[model samples]
Each structure stands twice: as structure tokens, then as C-alpha cells.
Target: MSTAYVLVEQNNGQLDHVTAELITAARVLGEVTAVVVGEPGTGQGLAAELGALGASVVVAAESPSVTGRLVLPEVDALHILAAHNPGPIVLSANLGGNEIAGRLAARLASGVLCDVVGINADRTADQSIFGDTIQVSAAVGGASPIYTLRAGAVAGEPVAAAGTLQTLELPAATAKDVTVVSATPAERGDRPELPQAKVVIAGGRGVGSAENFKTVLEPLADVLGAAVGATRDAVDLGYYPGEYQIGQTGVTVSPDVYIGFGISGAIQHTSGMQTAKKVIVVNNDEDAPIFDIADLGVVGDLFDVAPALLEEINKRK
Candidate 1:
């Protein structure tokens, strides 16, 4: 039986959604063992959830140094786990996960498949490339293949398991030349995170300015309870932070409903959000490219349309 190592990420002392997804994907290949890296005991309470999701074992590596050392310690811990269990290594396809997968593959001298959206029964990976213009299948040639899966790309299913917990020990990780002195968290907001939100409201150059975004977009979003996104043009103009930018160069999102205002629908921008289940575009120009993919298109100014829309929505409520 094959054994897969699934990297589990936790936030604010709870297991992130990606962990369950990875577990669900791993079960298709073989038995799953989750590798948790964080403050010691981070995996203790996660056993039941992980087990219920098909993770047979939870290998928790507690290290206060994980925060200070960056990705090196994670590579080391994964390296140790991979040595004992020779199979596929699965991780989220985020920035840090890509880096860690690359380094770990190099350390283990194995080939890697990245940005994987699906895994076949034979273990080959399915990936979307060329600004998501192409869907390709690839297989890594080696004893073990490392994969970085795109977040929200796969649905997680709950499977019964023993839910056993285990601890892994390694030599104290020595802080490398790169030391993180301090870290500040992003300000908290009530809106759902962009990648995970089922509904997203994005603005582009048409929103006019950052101030106007607050005046027009925020209220609509508040009424709909949607996460806010911005186009590359808007982000480059400093109307919003780079993190909120949704395009090929930024984060990819596959929400249930994506609403765009003043967005022209550049290929770079569409690549990231084309997977959304439903797209509604509000633009002044009838010839805008965004209308090509939008399920519903409005040829009017969002400033005029948004306020009325908000009022109507609130009136019904």
C-alpha cells in the first residue's frame, strides 16, 4: 500500500480548510499521514478531524523555531518524514508551499508536479497552465513525486479512520542566516477571505478611485456579504493592496458568484477568476471584454447602478 505525506496548515490554533482537502486527495492514492509543523502540540486536537477525513496518522513536529527560520525547518521535517515513507508528498499550491515543495524535492532528488488541480488513480497530476489556457497531465518519474495542489481546486470528503496521533522529533532546528525578528498580522476584517469566499465583488479601473471603491463597492459587498477583489490595474494604481488583486499574477479564485464593476476583463485578470460558477459584470463600455464571459452584463456606470442596487437589496430585506 502506498503512503502519502500530506502537509497540514493551521491558522489561529485550528486546522485550515486546505488540510481536509489535501487529506481527501491523498486517500485516492493510498494511506494518508498528515505532517503538521508549528508550535508543539498543534496536531494534538487535530487528530479527530484529520482521522475523520482519512488521515491515519498525524505526525506533529513542534518547534518554536518554525516561525524564526522560515522554510528551512519545514523542508528538514518533510525530508525526515519522506525518508521513512517513500511515496507522494502533497502540499498546498500557495507561495510558501511551492517554495517548500521545490526545496524538498531537490533535497530528496525527486521530480515534482506543481499547481496540481487533480490527481488520477495512477498518481499522475492534472494541472492548468498558460494563464489557465491549457489543461495538462504530468507524471513525476522517481520513487516519490512531490505535488503542490492549488487551494480550493479539490473538494474534501469525510472518510472514517482510526485517527491516531504521533509526534516526530528532530534535532533542534538551528536558525539560519535569515532570521525573522518580528511579524505583524494583517488587520482583521469581517469579510470572508478572498480565496475561500463563495461570493466576490471586484472592481477595476472603472471604480474611479480607492475612495470611490469604499463609497460604492463596500456597501454592495456589505449587503451581499461578499469578499472584495480588485483588478491588476486598480492594484497598480494603489487603489487596493496587492493581496486583494485577482488575476494571473495574483491569487486564483473559484468562487460561486463573482461580481465585477468597471472591469475590462483582460486575459491576465480573467485567467484567475474564469473558474467562478457565475460571473456578473457591470461596465460602462458595451464592448468591454469582461462581458464576453459574464453570465449577466450591465452597460452602465457602477456608481449609478450600485447605489440603486444596494437600496433595492436592502428594501427587500
Candidate 2:
């Protein structure tokens, strides 16, 4: 059977949720191995978790330069491991993950499938293309294929493995033309992150203003413990932060439930979230394109429907 390597990502000292999903996806292709790159001791701590998700072996590489220099550090580590044991590589479809996948694929001279939503029974990667109006399956012939899977594409199930952990020695850092001089952390809040949240509640141009978002959407999001999202129009209007914008040019998410308030569901916006398992839209315009994809549509003013829904949810709680 084939062996697939799952590159695990972590944040705030815990395994990134996508790691589990990658492990699950890898098993679909073949036997699964997990590769984790982090500071000293992160791999050992994460091995058990990766194993529980069906990783037969875990390779951990320690590097202080991981977050310091861009994607080279990760590519260097993968190059070493792949040299000895080459196989299909799976990674998450995020900013950093895409960079690493691209560089690594170039080094390996392998074809890469990006933002794949599923794996075919024949191991080809399934992708949503052209604003999700088309679906395509791609296979890499005569070479190991690198795949960057969208976060939340695969539902993870724990299937225990031996959980063997091994350390990979990183090579000397290569000279770089550019340097990372400074960085600022994002604002931290109690809510789950937009990409990883199982439930996402988003506001759009109809939310009116930032104050209205705070008054209407914030409470509903708080009650449901969901991450908040915004459309490009809302973000341009300064009703929400740029990071909250969901579109082809913004964050891509595949949540279990996506609830949009006053969102018209432009193709740019739908491209980012069409994979959601259940889409519920609340918009006044009955002809809004969002309802075309929604599993449930509430054609009413969000100001009235949202508060009433929250009240009902609270009463049930």
C-alpha cells in the first residue's frame, strides 16, 4: 500500500485542527504518516494525538527559524524526509501552507493540487473551480502528487496507530534575499477562529454599520459561540475588519453551518464558503442569490429575525 505524509500545523502550543483532517484525508489515499515542524518538544507532545487520528508514524523537526524565515525552513525539512521516504504529501490550504506546498512541489518537481475538497477513490484530488460552478478531478501520473487540502474538507475520525515519533535534523538555513524585520500579532478574542469554527455567523452590507454589527450580529454570535464573518462590502464600509471578510480574495472557510445575515451571496463570496455542509441565509430580498444555495432561507429583515431567533434560542437553552 502507498504511504502518504500529512504535514501537521499548530498554533498556541496546540495541534491545529486541520492536522486531524489531513490525517483523515491521508488515510483515504493510503497508510498515513504525520510530519510536524515546530519548536523543541512540540512533536513529542503531538504524536499521540496524530496517532489517535491514524498516523502510524510521526516525524517531528525542531527549528527556531520556522516562524522566523518564510517557507524555506519547512521545505528544507520536508526535502530531507522525502529524500529517504518519498510519498504523496498532504497540507492545509492556508497562506503559509500554500507557500510551503508550492516550494516543496518545485523542489520535488511534482505536480500539486491546491485547495482540494475531496480525494477520489483512485486517489485523484477533487477541486471546486470557477467560483464553484465546476468540479474537476486531477491525478499526478508517474510522480508523487502534493495536495493542499482546504481546512474542514475532511471530517476526522480517530483510528489509533502505533504513534511512533522520530526527530528530523534540519539542515543549515539558506541565505535569503529578504528578511522579516517586524511582526504584530492579531487581536485575540474569546471566539473561535473564522477558518476553524464549526459554525460561522456573518454580516453583510445590510448590517448597515459597525455599531449595528455589534448590536445585532455580536449577540447572536455570542449565543451560538460561532466565529463572525463579513462580506467585502461590509469590510470596505468598515463594518468589520478585513480579516473577517469572506470572499475569493479573502478567507476561505468550510464550516458545518454558515449563517449569513443580509448577504446577497455574490459569486466571490460564495466561492469561499460553498462547501459548507448547511447554509442558512437571512436576507430581506427573496431573490437574493444566497438563497439559491441555502438549505434554509429566511426572507425577512435580519434586525427583526436575528433578535427573535436569539430570544428563542435563549429560551430553549
What does the lDDT read for residue 194 in candidate 2? 83
What TM-score do all the candidates reach, one by one?
A: 0.95, 0.91
lDDT of 1 at 80: 91
Which numbered prediction scores highest in TM-score against the true structure?
Answer: 1
Residue-by-residue lDDT tens digits, candidate 2, 85-143: 77888888888889888888888888788899887647699987887789898887534
Per-residue lDDT for 1-317 in model 1, tens only?
78888988887468887887788887888888888887777778787888888888888877766667677767877899887778888999888899999998888889999889888768899998887889999998777789998877787787888778988874575535368889897795898888888899999998989998899998899889899999999999988889988988787788999999999999889988988999999999999999999999999989889999999999999
Task: Assess candidate 1 and give its TM-score to the true structure.
Answer: 0.95
Error of 1 at 122 (Å): 1.4
Model-by-model lDDT, in order? 0.86, 0.85
Best by lDDT: 1
